[model samples]
Target: MPELPEVEITRLGLMPLINHKVSQVVIRNSSLRWPVNLALNSILKDMPLVGLQRRGKYIFASFPIGTLIIHLGMSGRLCIASKKSAVQKHDHVDIIFNGPENKILRYRDPRRFGSITWTEDDPYQHKLIMSLGPEPLDNEFSADYLYEKLRNKSVCIKNAIMNSHVVVGVGNIYASESLFQARVQPHRPAHKISKDEIKSIVDAIKDVIENAINKGGSTLNDFFDVDGKSGYFQNEHHVYARKGMPCYLCDHPILQITLGQRSSFYCKNCQK
Candidate 1:
């Protein structure tokens, strides 16, 4: 699934659509994770895209009528396609822009797990986004906040960080990388971690996420940018998916375990 960095990249890629009026909306299929609003055509026609923003793994396209919330669940990708471009399989929806170039924003999802929804209310207060914790890259996700959130939690450290309510956008891959960077064992209980270690974890998460964004996000599976380009951050991973492989730091073999039903990788000798 595309995480925060990937979602942010998509949001950035869609910036050109801002200030452009929607000419038409073509929905080939409405059977996604949630039924796409069938009235999208009428709702968005002639509406200018005012802005594009990202929160967690969701992208918000702001317009006068409302906000279009998009989630690239699992294998979904949004790409810029020309009007003349051929429609390929899995091309579920298209938002044609009213411009000389006649550009189109196409959504393709092989698994059909992604969603496109509309909300006329403040998007931040939308039910899907209301309870989400502070973004990991924001100052609001400080060590003090995270320390308090986990003070009484018995969940594994990996699971704790992966919880969206604790801090948003730290997915499975980033969770392992962040913990490895912090030299914290993934299986340790969240409350058992020292305050100093929590601070390190906080810093590591920000650094890891920022670096991943710079690298275009990890392309371990079907994730790609709006230009159909793959991210190179997976090449820089420390322990994610390197199970049984040698650790880059201590040379001890990287170990893998399952926490919260997700695969977690860590260096036993280095991460304690």
Candidate 2:
């Protein structure tokens, strides 16, 4: 699934489509995770996409009338397509813009797990996104706030941080890398971690996420930018997917364990 960095990259790459009027919406196949609205054409007709932004993993294409929310589920991607481009298999939604450029934003998802939804009201208040945790890179996700959130929580540190309510966009791959960088064992109880250690984890989370974004995000599976560019962050990973390999810091072998049904890679000698 595309995480925060990948989503942000998608948003940035699609900036050219912003401020363009929606001439038409072509829903080739509406049977996504949630049905693509059949009335999108009528709803978005002539509405200019005034703002393009991302929150967590969702991209919000804002217009004066309302906003269109897009989630690139487990295997979804948006590409800038020409007006005359051929329609391929699994091509779902197409928002054709009315401008001199004559461009189209095509959404393709092999798994059909993505969604395209619209709301006339504030999208931030929508039930789908209202309950989400603070953005990991924002000021609300500070070490003190994280400490307060984890207090008395007996869940394992990895699971706790991975919790959407605790911090948004800390996916399995980045979580492992962040914990490894923070020198904390993934299975350690959240409450057992000291405040100093929590601070380190907080810093590690921000550093790991920023670094991943700088590298265009990890291309573990089908992740790609809006321009079909591959992310190279996976190559710089310290422990993720290096299960039995030698640790980069210490000579001890990196270990892999299953926690919360997700594979966690860590250096036993380096990460305590």
Candidate 2 residue lDDT tens string, 1-272? 77778778777778888888989999999999999889999989898989998888899999998888999888888887886788888888899999887889899998999898888899999888999999988989988998999989999999999998788899998899999999999999999999999999999999988887876633422343344553334558889999899998887899999999999999989988
Q: What digit string (tens of lDDT, one per residue) describes model 1 on residues 8-81?
A: 87777778788999999999999999999999999999999999988888999999979999998898889888
Q: lDDT for every model?
A: 0.88, 0.86
lDDT of 2: 0.86
Judged by lDDT against the true structure, how good is candidate 1? 0.88
Candidate 1, pairs of clashing residues: none
Global fold similarity of model 2 (TM-score): 0.94
- Candidate 2 deviant stretches above 4 angstroms: 217-232
Kindly report which residue stretches of model 1 are placed more than 4 angstroms away from their true locations once superposed: 217-227, 230-232
Clash count for candidate 1 is 0
